[model samples]
Target: MFSLRLLLSLIMLVGIVLTVTFSSILSTRDAKHEVEELFDAQMVQTAKMLEQFYVDQLTEDQLAQLISQPILFHVDDSKIETFAEQANPNTLSYEHKLSFQLLSSTGQILAYSDSSGEQQLTTFNPGYDTRIIDRELWHVYSFFSEPHQVWIVTAQRDDVRQELVSLIISNTWRAPLIITPIMMFFMLVLTYYLFKPVKLLERHLDKRPAQDLSPINFTLPTELASTQKALNSYLLRISETMIRERRFSADAAHELKTPLAIIKLHSDGLSDVLSSQSPDVKQATLPYIEAIGEGVNRISHTVEQLLLLSRVDAIEALNKTDCKLQNIIENVINQLVHIIADYEWYIVVPKDMIINVDPFYIELVLKNIIENACKYSPTESLISIKVTQDDQQTMICVADQGCGMSDEEIALAKNRFYRVDENTSQGAGLGLSICQHIISLHHGELTFSRVQPHGLDVCIVLPRAQS
Candidate 1:
């Protein structure tokens, strides 16, 4: 199974990493650009300062001599000069890559650094340019001195600019990389803390007993409040359903007592009549015997239907198997042989058709539907049972050629204890309800229709199960 927390954490971590990486790249690029601009500014300032000082104080020949000589300026000595080499006492680094040159208006190089060799530093365009000198790239900035009719050019090696840029970009990445682990640890902790309510809800459910269906109420974050409410509502509905079942059981028990008492009374009366041994007494005993038998059968049928209803309610899953349609219908007919003895019944079904269903429940449903057809149907009338199978569904229909019911009666027939003809004593009005529920358990539907020319047709449609 996939984990929610792991997925969420991965998304958050990846988004953070991408954001940090993009920000670092932009910052490095901006910092390098700024550093290059500052270096160029420094070069421009040096050129301007030399032009102001040298143009009035020294002739062109004097400036030429100073640039050609290239004297090393010591660190302890405080003589500031343009592109001067300052020796370091602590570090013995000797190379200074900065150099200067002076040129006349006619493009003749009047003076240049000894380290510069014979390289021309600039294009004399009064701006910055890159040029290759002695097979090494150099960054040069030139300024034309209008008053002295000469140009002062300052040049620095490209390696120095590249080294500074690398240092800036490397430092830009080092700080975030060093602290990324700590940030990620905190992020994980925060994500876990946010999901604590869900864990608590799981543990709470785990601790509850299976029979408990009470509503749950907990103080939680806004994100989880709706989930808690939905769970509570489901529990409340289950509790309501349980209450209805309990009330139905009590009603059934109360209803069974009347028939049992009638049976006992009729049995005692019949026994007394049989003991008398008179012709009239024996004649009277026949009706009493019939009454007792009818009561017993009615009570037994009611009890069986009640028990079947309760079992259907309690069953959480159905053990469906391949059952022959003809076999189940034959079994139902055999079970109802006594009741249907007076009626002409017909079974119309294919020879070897099978359906996937719980055999016991299906049989019970068949018995109830067929028994109802026998009860409401007139004696010697035709009762037709048809089982048909197609690619989409399996249908079992029980139709009776008797006095059909009204629309109102058909609508109320499925309600427990609701009888179309209350005067009839054969059923407790639970047969159709039980049948409907059993079919529903298999994810099927039960429908009632009036047969043409005066009869009732009841059908059960079940979806075809995979082989």
Candidate 2:
């Protein structure tokens, strides 16, 4: 995908090139027309000068000699030169392209330049005309001088006029051609710098943690402020909804605890009363009472988990104390002593390494993962918790010899209330979901994988606390 900066730069470049091209075309054409008009005026002026200066004063012999040889003098006598000498040494090798012919009113040639050869440049008409001589085209300007009773004609070769026009047009177009690319380069660079804020905003959003819904914190250009405001507003709405859900879960858990305890207490009392009866009465009544007790216990456990989920974020944020990794793991193992009774356990973590985190939340995550492993695995299965570190991050791996799950199950494990085995009703399937949220709050990741030879493995990665 092309960035906005590049797209805008291309647009401006195309527009500038087109505008320059169009302007050059129009200016060149106008310049060519002006040059042609000026050349024609000069031709008229030359004819008039010849008529006034030498036409009537020439004797027949002098006129005949002049016919064979053209006069070569600059209008300013101070700059006179022989016809054989060049007019401009700086110009391309000069050729005598200008020729003149003097004729009577009845079309009889009185005098003509040697350059004219044997050609009548045009009829004795009082205007401009194009004529061909020796297959070469010439532009001739003719006028009648009434006092001299003569027609004066001045002609220039068509090829020479064309060469002059081309030179003027090339010079006119040169500046824009040379300067346009430089302007386009700066325009592209300026456009990129001008849009720097937009690029910064994009990178900021892309790097943000998925669970971080905080408002953006940066000053923006006026044009982008509205976009930023809309994004913040949506984030605020999502935050409010999450807060409400957390509050509801906490309140419902608090409300259910009392009734669930009462139910357990009544079931235990009933079981005690039936134990004193005969074997036949005990057999049927005790099992029902035990089932009622188990149901109550399950409900109570679920309520406690819900309550922990509700307050995990706020609690973790408030508890920013440094604690040793070994101490936290020992506390979690103590809490799960009863559940892990049927499992073989191992821990490989340093006793001196410290982590900056909430002890309660960290222990809660460990408890949930360990409890999950025990619940799924067969009795006396091998379970291990290993911790290691690198320069930038801390890693914890929990492996269990449980029946492994499929790819689909591992993917959905982080979703709330999603269970790998739908037939098992022992848990509400919120254990891994809650663990994921807790890890994410601490800027960490929790991932599930299949252990080799029919087992499950989980890994937690967190950034190392700076000393």
Candidate 3:
């Protein structure tokens, strides 16, 4: 079975096919009709010429004399031969086939032109008039001046009519053959013209880069406005959903990392401590005990953070609060002293700067961003954190002069488990999502962009709470 779209196109093509076929059949029928008309007209003219031939040669009084002549079993060929010699060759050639017969109004056969038969009565009526004719049949209306009589003549063979009908049918089929290519060309062009937007949309989709989720920028005509609007709406929704999912994943990884590190540390310490103990004496080995404990703790930590991420992803994170931004940054920095200790880092925030936010949530946001920078940056690379007061908001930016990311990598940074290079950076993909949730909670905007020359730059804009 064909698809619905394909079926519709095929139906259109079929309509064209039927139209062409109908036209061809009609032309053939008309041609056959015309051929019949011509045959009847020629037959009438032949009868008239026979009338003229008799008028030119015989006097009015001699008509009865001719009629009174004895009927014979065969024609007198000698008279016809003399007649043919006296007439023009073309007239003889044309009139040679005109059969003649004498008939009474009572349908009695009197005589025939050839006098070849007397018993067989042929069909002749005085009632012939304009009417549809059968093939090879001719109607002749004639007058005998001497007897002052009229007669109708006809022939009954179907040769000429059948030949003409065949010719018409044959000739008519050619019309469709000639017309098909033209109709097909037009149909193809029309189909393409109608489908241009859909094809273009597909091409645009195919060419899109891996991380690009921007709005479609193709032109759709006014006729397709509703369709274009629908597609655009769908695209926007998908982009938003994908962005949200990516943020959630990154935050979950970052949130679980601290607990994961602690479990691993504890497990290692337990194994070292149990290694010297008697292995044969205790069936419940201390190493296995420690391993199970660490595994359970790690799983629990990962699950709990994932749940928190899920909640933050919900709509409740939009609720804003009043808090101090500068204090949040200070708290985040102090939490990461050991991680940033050996590296050269600069903080350019003013002492008195503050902004409205959920204080604890904002602190979590700062901690995630700062800790991510500390983890990804190479040794001796400078990490810069700045808070500048804008007219209506405070702009907090954390950037590092480490390995910069392309547009694709920068956009992917917030996705869970996404690291610039996973083998080099020890991270679970949860940091940026937590920061994003905190930003959302404070009604602040957090965006990631590539800094000039190298490295990733994250910007956080929080509207100032007026004093």
**What are the lDDT scores of the predictions, listed in order?**
0.79, 0.80, 0.63
Give the C-alpha lDDT of model 2. 0.80
lDDT of 1 at 274: 88
| The candidate that achieves the highest lDDT relative to the unseen native structure | 2
Cα lDDT, model 2, residue 464: 92
Q: Note the residue pairs that clash in candidate 1.
A: none
**Candidate 1 structure quality by residue, lDDT tens digits, 35-69:** 78987988898788877875567776775675565
lDDT of 3 at 450: 78
TM-score comparison, 1 vs 3, better candidate: 1
Error of 2 at 375 (Å): 3.4
Q: Which stretches of candidate 3 lie over 4 Å from their true place?
A: 1-9, 24-61, 64-124, 128-147, 150-157, 165-170, 189-197, 220-225, 258-285, 292-467
Q: Could you tell me the lDDT of residue 50 within candidate 2?
A: 86
Question: Per-residue lDDT tens digits of candidate 3, residues 147-186?
Answer: 4352424332234456557766866777677777777777
Clashing pairs in 2: none
- Residues 68-143 of candidate 2: C-alpha lDDT, one tens digit per residue: 6645422222242233354555332233467788876666676676556546786877889988877778889998
Candidate 1 local lDDT, residue 427: 72
Report, for all candidates in order, the number of backbone clashes.
0, 0, 14
Q: Which ten residues in a row have the lowest lDDT in candidate 2?
A: 73-82
